[model samples]
Target chain A: MISTKELSRRGFLNMGAAAGAGLVLSQTGLIRPAHAAAPLAPVKAEEALIAFGHTGPTSDEGWTWAHDQGMKAVEAAFPGIKTTYVESIPYSADATRIFRQFVSQGANMVFATSNYGDFLYDVAKRAPKVGFYECDGRNPLDNLGTYYVQHWYPTYVAGIAAGAMSPTGKLGYVASFPVPSVYSGTNAFLMGARTVNPNATLQCISINSWFDPQAATQAGTALLDNGCDVLFGIMDEAGYLQVAQDRGKKAVMWNTDLRRYGPDAYISSIVVNFNDFYVKQVGRRLEGSWTPTYELLPMGGGVDRDAWGATVPAEVAAKADAVRTKMMTEGYSPFVGEIKDAKGNIKVAKGQTMTEQELYHWNWSIEGVSGLDG
Target chain B: MSTWRLQRLPAASPLVSLSARLISVVLALVTAGIILAATGKNPLDLGAQVISSTFGSSFGMADLALLFTPLLYTGLAVAVGLRIGVWNIGAEGQFNLGAFAAAGVALFLPGPPALILPLMAVMGMAAGALWILIPTLARAYADVSELITTLLMNFVAALLVTYVATGPWLDPSGMALATTARLPVEVPAVWDIVHWGLPVGLILAVLLAVAFGFTRWGYEVRIGGSNPGNARYAGMPVRRHLITVMLVSGAIAGLGGMMEVAGTVHRLQGGISNNFGYIGIMVAVLARAAPLGVIFTALLMAVILNGGIILQPQGLTTQTVLAVTGLILFYAAIGDEFARYRLIRNAKPAGTR
Candidate 1:
């Protein structure tokens, strides 16, 4: 019954009034607020609780310690959110129990750092409400996320530095399991050394555990005895560095800074800073928009950076800087170009760049690895 | 030379026994409190948390029951071994072998449910006994210490399980890590919450206890164990008794492994026992090798283990629980020692003066 202009003005005023009422309700805590009103449905108000499971005690003061530090940083960045953790969870049914308990205790997100991925996935299925993130590169499900450092890239870069600095062409790599993650890092080191010194050879050994100082020491001793002048470890334990120091050989470390463990022998180490990725994901989860998918952050994902230990000589700093720059800026992937499996099968051809998904599902061993079944 | 008399030792009074137990429990609590204080925790609060977590809910109670089932078996095994003066540290090895055998039966034998279930359990028990045979023989013939042989056999058994899980027995669709195939759901359920094997394990433990307490063979074994020379003089076959005790102990441990595989995991994984055999030794010692006491001690340990997980979410470490358990064991031992020997002060001052 009203004119067109009057009718339009009245409708606009009514809409404005409704919005005002919503704003008041939201401010007074009477109604739940949306993340963004226009584009996506407003995300629900969620309290993100990130759970980190470690195979060893936090007092191990190396690999688990570094990861715990990063988790602590995430907790600090986000107030009103909690971070729950279970240390020394055995890689068996006990691990499954702990994961189930975490989810039951309102852990919205979980980071399983151990290689027991098979059990983790089953637990994840049982706990659909909780999101799962595995540090190992196993076949992930829709609700399970997998992420790992491009350890090979940094290992090769460090290897080049070790090669150029070494008086002898012999290098030693003390490995944990024969899994693809450790294999890739070992093969990359060999390739990096070969790039610098074409005649260089790498001696590799697997101790079948992620952290066993005694085993690492024995393996390191054997490698050193076998004409390896420089040492490196793809294991979480820093015992290799201690052995290298005792033998007076240059050493490369993984997972944590080995300056304290082997101050004299530590040259450079690859440190995994999972906290950076964890913080961003946790922020989203806190805003109630958590998604379950693989998050493969390249060298930029807070890893692939080297933390030069106190043992690294000042003269090698410039060379290490040059190598790191090349890796970070040039998009130098370890899987690029022709590569062979341990069985002498060609894995990657020249001019080939593996997609992130392929890297995530890598199931083959690299060239020069021995004593591995698969 | 005309007359001689032998005096018999009087029986320990009930009041003394009751006081001894009470004092032991108090001592254990005090020791636990000291350890907690050293670790910067409130002992009372920690104790309460453990109690509440263990018996809080139906799920918690089920977890306790599942934990207790294995402990109960291991406790019974150790108690029987102790009664024969044989330290069977090989219960762990026997249990693992039993689990492996059970897995074989469950996986390979395809038959009607009625036939497969009981058959698998028997096979598991037999496998456990066979595994302990080497240690038993070594102790009997080679004069090797059963303690060392049994303990060493655990490593071999664990590795064997590992090899099978990683290679021949591995699940085809399993991940790169070592593990077995998913078990079938038809494995019987004891309670709606706890697995069915738990009731079986408890029943076996009770039956063994009753047999040990009431039967003539039980009395013979007890008499032989207390004094081998006297038993031999009484015409009891000491060596035969020893072998029978070892076999029974190993068989009981094997049944625990069967329950773990057929009821819970359904696969033989490495380190499945998780030192249950070792804990059984402690339980046996705490119970003074009595069948009834073994039941109670096993339940206490299970409560601690199940509750330990619950306390983890509340920022308490497993070490805290371990410390408390050690304290309890220490107190129990002290109480036992006091029961055997009376403390007396010598009045030498007046004589010296």
Candidate 2:
């Protein structure tokens, strides 16, 4: 078990650290670099290049599982590449040692999948020859490339489903930390909730952790206790979804189709698809055109909409599909003008969509999200 | 009533005792190997992989020193505490308090290394000692359980550090993560800066071990811990011993925290410790609470742990690494058990091997 997440179960770490994002994005002011358009060819096809993975656990069956699948896909797609992974590595000095060992062992590419990975820059900057990717980490050094999932797009779509289906018009959001990423995702969910029902409000509870099954359960109960009918949970496990199932309520799925965990309370999930993004990065590195980047999942390239059980009606799924299509084809963003913060302060004016700058520095909870002022 | 019962024989020969310990260790390894094999992991050369990865090269060796320096401090602290019957379970908290204390000095009270380094050590150790002050006082005066009180104080320390880390002492530039500001004055290196504060750790460990062996207070502490009632009956100041041991244990463990901050990390972060305090318990147990033995045991534990990280790429999970450590610890405990009590059958079979 990854102590960073699992130790939260014991209630020691209340500050669910939001990875290396705090290292440079706002300081550098490049959420999306224009240099990403340049493509490179695969040069390592003839020779073996070892790809090393450092993450929490592939056996996690959640966020880490999704990344593991992407790694497997990359390994399978490239016939000449060999893959090695060290699971449940905490983001610390040991992490630096682990990375150095990977390099010494002849690993050409390394992917560290922890948000709390600013130290990866220390390791990557020193090892100039090796390509370092921080999975879901902030965009940091030139040697290190940060590839994060824009499950927010899919989260918006899930919000749409939750908006239409919540009979009480009160949705619950059990989130881990009040970071910009989670804040943005929950705001997107609230935006989706309002898309179908203008009066719908999301009651969000931050357990200040990422993976505490017990905390998730307690927060889920609190949200339900406060009259929230549909729940949306972030982080690796969906223990809250299981609570939703037991309570006979619907909750939106996250990162994976965890409907199996709580099939009875299933709502379509915002599945994370990183295969396309991973392949693109490795291809870029091989052909020597890799540039440091920080961008949301390229539309549908890194995130997708998944089917929930029969609990989610076909009409809700169709609406979610329509939004997903518009986002993929027409580049639709829910961060349009007329958006307001929790305090009814105008954040984005009419005819103005939120910029990546605003998104990166996201501080305020959007309108229709309650209970996070604490 | 059961037909059979355990009987303790007189002290066995040293060779017999040594063989029993070795046999227990071999048994633990075999058991671990079987479990790993059952779980679809290759048990072949597992230990080799760990060793080669952690202590394989010159750099690896230096890194090993860097990792184990804290273990040495914590190990010695626990060893010393156990020997005095203090049972300072708040080593983890003391370590954290020490880190915060060092950070406080570096951030708020700055000076050159000559002035600040010693100040940091004193403040850190004082903070650690203060962290155990209440619990130790309770244990000494009210006859409260040290184990529970110290354990409870650990939580207080964790929360206190987290509060300061995320609130007042937080690094303004740390991108919304739990970390304290950087320290200006850090412990310097001896030969290579790579090992950071490791040489100091070694010097401290050896000196303390020697003192524990030679000093009059050390002798008294041994007597106090081994038999507190006997110590009191002998007109020894048991209360004073309790307070002294608890404070010293906290102070040494606090040094472990400072080592990480001044030697390696340079800043206190959320991941400052991966249970260095808890692991020191294993080291103390393995060393039989002898300060000299603590140095070797902590080094051995650190090697096993650092080496085990290499096995992760070989399909070993953190749990797997922990299982290996646990098996070794189990073997060590069994060795201690056998050393304490010689096994004798109530009725020996006719053809005993």
Q: What ranges in model 1 sit over 4 Å off?
A: A1-49, A116-126, A137-144, A163-170, A197-208, A305-332, A336-367, A371-374, B1-23, B38-40, B104-120, B163-176, B181-186, B341-353
lDDT of each: 0.70, 0.72
lDDT of 2 by residue, B35-74 (tens): 8789877677776676676667776787677778888888
| Cα TM-score per model | 0.82, 0.85
- Candidate 1 lDDT, tens digit per residue, B90-177? 8888888888888888777788868877877788789888887887887766768888888898888887877677557765442345
**Poorest lDDT segment (10 consecutive residues) of candidate 1 chain B:** B1-10
DockQ of each: 0.12, 0.33
**How many backbone clashes does every candidate have?**
2, 3
**Fnat per model, in the order shown:** 0.19, 0.32
